[model samples]
Target: MSIEIESEDVIRLILQFLKENQLEHTASVLEDETLVTLNTVESRDTFTKDIAQGRWDTVLKQVSHLKIPPRKLMDLYEQVIIELVEMKEHSAARTLLRQTEPMFLLKQHHPERYLRLEHLLSRSLFDPKDAYASGMTRDKRRQIIAQALGSEVAVAPPSRLMTLLEQCAQWQHQQGILSSDADFDVFQTTATVESKEDADALANEIYCTIKFPGKNAYAECSLFSPNGQYFVTGSVDGFIEVWNHSNGKLRKDLNYQAEDNLMAMDESVISLGFNSTSELLVSGSTDGKIAIWKTQSGFCQRRFSPAHSQGVTSVCFNRQGTEVLSGSYDKTVKIHGVRSGKSLKKFTGHASFVNTVLYVKDDTCVLSGGSDGTIKMWDVAEEACLYTINPAMNSSAALAVQSILSVPLITDQVLVCNKSNRLALMTMDGKVTKTFSHGKEKGADFISAAASPHGELIYAIAEDSAVYCFSVASGSLLGETKISDSELVGISSHPLSNIVACNDDQGHVYCISSK
Candidate 1:
């Protein structure tokens, strides 16, 4: 009643179906009008097969002139390479490998896949089936294959110089020490950095030094209002200090502790945020709790625990200020309704502690970065993870990431920080378009970055007690200023040209003009 066709008959049927479906018209266009006809039929076949399998090398070898759409190529490669690798077709894979070096290099960027590819390449190079002459026994062939697959690539670790530099950086940061000279332009300066010092003297002549209380190390700070009327500072001392930016005046200081029953010295405020209208201030603390306060009256409005079992590292209010997003050491990002102080949805995807969370484009989506060295884009409205970007994996040289700050230069792209303090420009879909660094000063870990709404320039703070102005178009440091007695903490840009506001770790805020 049923018939099973042979492989040859199946191929014939496939060809017939393709022809009847008018797929031949598409295939013929490649041969008739396209440059693909320049290559032999065998080469074309191999190339098409490779393209179908994501063997970019084969297709590129037979036809490199044709502009291969990047998205299509990636999709094809993801589909094919994964299938063939799972099938253990090492020889066939090697054929594709020999044609494409960039594709191989890209795969090598992925640590896990790199190891597997190395094993596959090693096996293909010395498999016993192809190693010895004819008449080899099954056991002998199996042994050879095992030997081939077992071989691993030999690579040397980083040298002493690299390790020493890394050690120096960590020691400097932990001790709250800043380097004297900037290796790159647009360097951030500290209170110790005088306009007369080295590069600081060479770059800017007239700059202002923002002096802080220097009483306690400020953990973080944020703009008090969109109009830049005032700024708020939070510290490990469990206090939220507000300062009037119009003139140096202490406006208010708000502090609270869990009821008398709970007392802990480790309850430091870690992050701060403001609503869209800047009428409310939200502070996250080391106690894994969030406190919202009325900015005008300095009254504590609500207290939220939100089920976070670890310290909240970062907090941000959505565009409308109706909801708030918070990232914590518990490896989860939780969204909370502002008015009700109710937990909305908890995004649990990061394998490590999340360092920062940001609302993107009118709160249509949110971007979160973590110690796991990944940036995840979440659709808040849909409650779905749109995509993830691992710039650390693609980078050839970068330290393990310490923090991530997203600066939306435009509505289309989101700029995020990689381990090297480099800005990785990513599309909304999570594809990294480029990696850019400003002020090239080595050891200049970005404490904060703010892009102007017009997308012309960006203002950033370096670990040092300085501020840097960057040209977003050229990815170059435009101008810099040295601020004495202030370790740069946060930065925010005016909607227009380079007018910027910066906050220091010492509870000080200053305004600067780039003109």
Candidate 2:
């Protein structure tokens, strides 16, 4: 009986030891399955609370004193740290995870979000922790992008274009997420050019006028050049005239007069352009033909007959001057090679007669407007319709977009005319930064628009025979010139001058100086 009492007491002491060490439940459950009910939900909750509230620190310190493997302790720390981080208790969360170092898991699950968080943390380390400060940072970031990418380019269709814009928005969203402060600074910019120029100093201006010595009336002129030195003008007189605008001298005038040909209408020269080297003049006439004329000497180089059923309205030269694009009253635009003068491509998406086409730089993109009251972007390379410049919601849909002129005024911004007595300053991506409207004048129609060589001012001529100037940045009307009683259908600003030249509905032209 004495031996039995000693053995039972020893067992009791061991049981108490296990309980103090937090292994009592496990030991008891292992001894008899029926006793496992002691490790019930309520008991487990109490145990976990004790472990979570610093009681486990003492137990962990005691465990450190034991001969346990360092790896096992690290595993426990990782499990606990992951739980804390998942619960938004990041500080404590980081402490636990750092012990085990599960960085790969964090990076894999959240790349962009984690990047943003990292940015915020870095910012906070050097700055104050004001949440609103992030707003200002976000604005600054946007200003930087807007300043750098001042214009947006329209590449694909409306759907794809929307996707690109959304990416920009996403970038902006990330910036907002990464910013820690909102009240840092506001930036102010100054104009580079003076607001006024002395009248006497404006003598270096250019004065251009269209003169026709032909029998047929000079209905209209599409004036353009490869090099500014020599400009080519097309008129209703069935002629394309290349002039030395550099010194106000006539260079070469080539007439494509039909011999005794019965089918030839050759009504007039409606649109014209010069090849890159200024060696070939491409003209689209009232008759359905596109004619290429040699520049060095007046001669017919080649002729293309994708022939508009109606009148050809506009023609343009691609940046390389290898391709010629024409828009016609038959509601089609065609692309042809300069060397062969053969139709290489054609665009027929416009519902109404296509009026004007502008090739953008060396890219295959083209901007076209027509009587359909729509301005469309096309990729001549892909032969795709990218998108249409959405007409302003409040404006009349009935207002025809008779013409469109795109002047790359700034690096990424284009100045445009829509024939609605208004001008639009837009990004290549189709975002309108500003619009200038010529309020309703009884008989006025905004016909022509051109950007100054310096890109500081934009000049526009109205059918009411008035030429107006506006500040490109501020959109303020700077000046105006009233010249003729007939409507001014065309206008060109001198590359080196304050002088503006304009043509009227009657085919007469004038040169006026702002001075």
Candidate 3:
């Protein structure tokens, strides 16, 4: 059985929420100290009945605070005034027509109706039952009127806090700080944005710069968090650092030191990746060590020591975050379960050092590139090589693949870069569909590359410290911005905004804005 109150109010609903959740002491304190309240309606049933039964006096007394439109109020007045005339209460009907401001406007705008009322008054006769020609009873007419005003007077759903946070999330997404496809927990996360309106499309200039702690530390690899709040960089000096997204400051709090006086791995860091939610981050080192850290606390949650006999070149987590996919100079790719701390499967047959590896086709396949100038697709379940991509066989390029990048939010296509004079977009198989090239007679090869989250633009960093921008659809060069005198070795694009983080071999990470 449900009990009914006169009406719902904020404080009472809050109290009910508190008490229902076993927060009696807090509820008591809230009830005793509460001053804020919702705009309350008393006995909503009786109030609605007064309107539907044509008790205009009662309704008129309560309607002012509802803030219903003046036009609607005028219609209500006309209904009652005509009913009074039908009831032979001419003086009462005339008072509303001439005295009330809304009724006065209605009379001025509709002279013919006013004239009919005057004629009826002159005749001294009318029918109360036939006040409306639509044949609706007076009671039914009032019910219809009440129904029309139902939305205006009815109380809105509670929990203004959630509504406000949801609105904020939506607005931030529209403002381009949060991508239209990404959202955040407003209660726990504040939208930290350094975006400009013009930069929403592409980035051309360096926005800010962050240098590693040591002058000689080179950032070998970099990547952004999924939520776009932070980005992590792997340096040649055996340190993996995380930085704040909106500012170029180091997030020292996320630097977890496993042992006393130790900051990172014993060997130089080579690659890095964030799990789907950014809850965990996995770092691969030059000496074939892999460390998974709790992102929030920066704790070394797990490690796979000597996962490969040589340097771990690239690393990422499966979408479920339960498994890790890694490639190494050992010329092998392997999947390791995070919980069991065991190697699950290994794919072989790359003749040289594997440069990169990633899971594709819904985590059922492994794709890898190698220094031997070939890219191989392997079936994850069967541990068999599906196909290999050798660029020399299909194009006039001098090399195969140095890196393979997945276009964010897009499946079936990935960006491929190599020592060749061209960059191409290829499918999960070995077929190339689009290629990007330049006529600047040069021997500078692309060391690293990243694509826009929506697959609109491509940012490839060359060994000459030049960042080339290319249109994904047209395969045309949009522009190029040189970042440093030193060779830029790595690049990472923001997951949501038009910002790219590129790092040089001399230890500086430049955050460039599309605006």
Candidate 4:
């Protein structure tokens, strides 16, 4: 049965117990702190006194006036009848048994017991000791009634706090979200609390600007190292530069040429990614080549030339950094081994250029988005297409997907942006949970979008040279800021901080941080 225990009732019970125990000083202090006053109820007191004094008529009248529960009234009637018989007041007990509803309820629910009580009325003078033979004392019976009344009137049981905690744990477990090692004590720690100062600092305005040189050789792509210590940018001039992200100082010119032999640079670097340890860097080029570089030496360790029939557009390392997945304009996605320099898998079926590709479903499957306006899931082990999603197939306007990014903190959803000036949060199975649009008037065609580290926000760069922020959960537009006067070509979020770096077509990079 559901029970609700009110705070006032609990305080009153404590005060009543304290007063009964003669702890006057402590009771007064508690009453002062809780602002509770002990007010006596004359009618309730009279009803109790009448029961103790064997005044059946008065007890019945008070119970009827108070509108007590039928069951409780029946219990009180049973107790009073037994008491009346024990006191040899048989006539009074018989009169009450005939007049009350409790007699009818007892007859209906407990006919044998009702018949035994009825037999008591027939006796001229029964032994008083016989009625008291049940071994239950009057004080114990009164205590039982009081306990039942307390439970019926309370808002919740005494163990409500523990019950709520258990429910929470069960819910988390059913959702397959709770860690096996987590316990109730985790809630009491400061680790669960978010730092408002750190949040404000991360949300602050653009604090640093990392400028790239060369007017025509703008950066095509930018990525922050997984450790967040370095930022790397791939330029249209075929040079990849790594910078100390915090200070904007050049740490290594990864594409610098030596005197004896020139570093391989057949075309502009379009995509770049760092492994989990930040020890290996991978870059895809327009010449259809994928190169793996040793980060410490800035030297190429493995190269997969003609990785695709057309230019490689996107590339990323899997969770272990042992495998690389890349998408190409040739309408195919390929996975390559980092050490073996061998193609592990190739997924085809995109009607148009594959714009982006990544490992999903615990690196067991690949998700790729194409310019053909379709996203496909491929089973890596089977080398077969599992599902294909066309986001704009129902619309009259053709929409080419520009970018697909994994939503941080959410495992099943990804952020998708298309040329239709629309952005959608979609599930791995191709279901659109929420769609965001600039409306037909704005004509804001998105170039790219990045998710915050916490996955609470998404930042999209549109053709208007403005960056728009949105809430990931509700798909609400949070705000917008103009990052450049010209079109922005690429945007990257810091892996470990609330820092966003965007590169413009004019070879300028702006670092934005939260305040």
**How far off is residue 179 in model 1, in Å?**
38
Candidate 1 per-residue lDDT over residues 1-515, each given as its tens digit = 11234554334334334444678776455444533321122333344444444444554353443334443333334333433554677666565544554456546565554455556556534443433348864344334432322221111232433454467555443322333442422233221333223211112232333445568655455554543434566666677766544344454322222221211124777788788677888888887898887765566777787447899988878777778789999999999887888999888888888888888766777888888878788888788888877767355643334445445335567766645556656776777766556546576766666665345555666776676666666777666677535567666554322345676666555656432
| lDDT per residue (tens digit) for residues 1-515 in model 2 | 00123543344344444555689666576436422221112233333334444344543444332223344444334334433433455676455443433333444554653354444333423332332234554234334322322122111222333454457445432322111222222131111233344111212222555555544455366454433444555666665555445344445222222221111126677776676666777777777788776654556777886457788888777777777888999998878887875788878788888888877745568877787777788888888888987544257654556556555347665666655667887676778888776576456667768766566778887767777777776887776667777766776654433445566657665655543
Please tell me which model should have the higher TM-score, number 1 or number 2. 2
The digit string of per-residue lDDT tens for model 4 on 15-116 reads 656766789898879878987645323444444555555566665554543435678777778777877776778888887777778878888988877777
Residue 513, candidate 2: C-alpha displacement in angstroms: 3.7
- lDDT of all predictions, in order shown? 0.58, 0.56, 0.76, 0.74
**Segments of candidate 2 deviating more than 4 angstroms:** 1-216, 222-226, 243-265
TM-score of each: 0.52, 0.54, 0.64, 0.59
Rank list by lDDT: 3, 4, 1, 2
- For model 4, the superposed segments whose C-alpha errors exceed 4 Å read 1-193, 200-204, 252-264, 440-442
Worst 10 residues of 2 by lDDT: 177-186
Q: Residue by residue across 294-410, what tens digits does model 3's lDDT show? A: 766667889999899999999999999999999999999999999999899999998889998988888998889988888899999899998887864365544746889788655
User: Clashes per prediction?
Assistant: 10, 12, 3, 15
Rank list by TM-score: 3, 4, 2, 1
* lDDT head-to-head 1 vs 4, winner: 4
Off by over 4 Å in 1: 1-214, 217-219, 252-266, 381-384, 393-409, 433-435, 439-441, 484-487, 494-511
